[model samples]
Target: MKTILPFFPLNLVAFPGQELNLHVFEPRYKELVRDCVANESNFAIPSYVKNKIEYGTEMKLVNIAKEYSDGRFDIETKAINVLHVLNMQNPYKEKLYAAGDVEILTNVDNGDIILKEALFESLTELYKLVEIQKVPLNTDFRVFDIAHQIGLSKDAEYDLLQLREERQRQRFLLDHLKVILPQLRDIQKSKELIKMNGHFRHYDPLEF
Candidate 1:
């Protein structure tokens, strides 16, 4: 279905089921949040990548986390669906923030169990290598829910927004893991070495 939504362009990508907390300090976005909360409306957070607005996620404003003295606000939102921009109008209807006509993109879960398990395991291991002991998992989870947690880049996360198939998203994130896990391990190893520097090392000189 197509509809118009308030647009809040951000440098970050918000994935489905992800909770995003935003500070609304700008005059435009402060008004945006107020309107959303008053009307119980959802807004689009278009990923501002490479100086251009691209694909985005539709998010429901959950609550006003806090309100500053100067009328600024801290708000919490949850990404509920993906949005494909039909077009956007800046200063929409003379309002401060931009608005967009968008089409909702639905996700297809083929339930590729093997692929899901593989991706999940790899994600867990990636966190483990970084000494993250408890990684959260939803019993019935979509790949989008964990994409941000698995170290996918903002660009890659935006790419995932375009994908409808769960298996495909899994593969996309797995590729990110393949590239990042090794680098994280190397970094961890370096950190370990740095910490061990100046520690006492008592060993036999040469036992040849």
Candidate 2:
């Protein structure tokens, strides 16, 4: 069904069942937050593509993680569903928000157990390496949830968001990581070689 939702355009994509933490500082968005809190309405987060895109995810406010004295908020939200934008009457005219007719998406299945298990294993390995390298992540989830955190390119992330089948999404993620793992291993090996020489820089630079 079509609904007029308060819209927030972002540089990132949000997936169903994922949690997003946002710091809302703009006045219009603060108003949006107030409206949501008062009415329990869901908001839409569409990826901004120079021009606004017509697809996005519907988000439900979960908690106000923090509130500044200035009325800004550090809020957490969960993706409840997807939406297809039907029309944008104003096109980003709002200071910190937008409005549009978004048709809610339904019928996508939850992920399968086997795919979830495999994804967890791959993510665990990935995070172990990340931890060893001392990268920091604010929130944690199962391996499947890591897909929501890794910095996939915009188009790649949009493609992932389009996969409606749980197994298909899992397989796509597995394939994506399989391609990435080799490159990551190569980078690590190169780093190790450079470290052995006490330079702590890329080994290829030594050849120069």
Candidate 3:
């Protein structure tokens, strides 16, 4: 479905099911926040990267955590869904914030079990290489839930955000993890090799 969403362009890519705590400091956005809160409505944060606002997430303002004496706000927002911008207006007519006609993107969760298994293995290894003790996946988790934490670049994250299928996102991340995990392991081995007085040492510590 289509929507006329208010735009708050941010440099970071936001994903569905992710909860972000944002500090609203800008005057234009402060006005936007106050309007959304007062009207019990929501706004959109278009991903602004490489000097473009192409796609973003529809944010549901969960709580107005605090309102300062100076009209600043500390708010909690959750990314509800991904949206693609069809048209944009800077300052949205008379208002100081932008607005746009956004197309709510389709997101399907019909992924293969085998692909999910592969993802679990690859992501677990990925976290291990970073010395992170816990993998975020615990039997039943989603790719969108941890896409931002897996060393993905801004462009890659944005690419993933545009993908409409769960399986597609899974495979994209799996391929990325597969390609990067070896490089990371090699870098780790180089570090270990340096520690070993420059002797060539090969080690396999990360389980697939």
Residue 69, candidate 3: Cα error in Å is: 0.8
lDDT of 2 by residue, 106-206 (tens): 64566678877776676656766555465333333433355665546778777777666667777888888788777777887887777788555554555
C-alpha root-mean-square deviation, candidate 2: 6.4
Number of the top-ranking candidate, with lDDT as the measure: 3
Score every model by TM-score: 0.84, 0.73, 0.91
Q: Candidate 1 residues 41-157, lDDT tens each? A: 999998887677868889999988899999999888999998888899999998999998999987787768887888778877887886777877755677876776776667777
RMSD of each: 3.3, 6.4, 5.3
Which ten-residue region of model 3 has the weakest summed lDDT? 133-142
Better of 1 and 3 by TM-score: 3
Task: Please report, in order, the local distance difference test score of every candidate based on alpha carbons.
Answer: 0.85, 0.76, 0.90
CA lDDT for candidate 2: 0.76
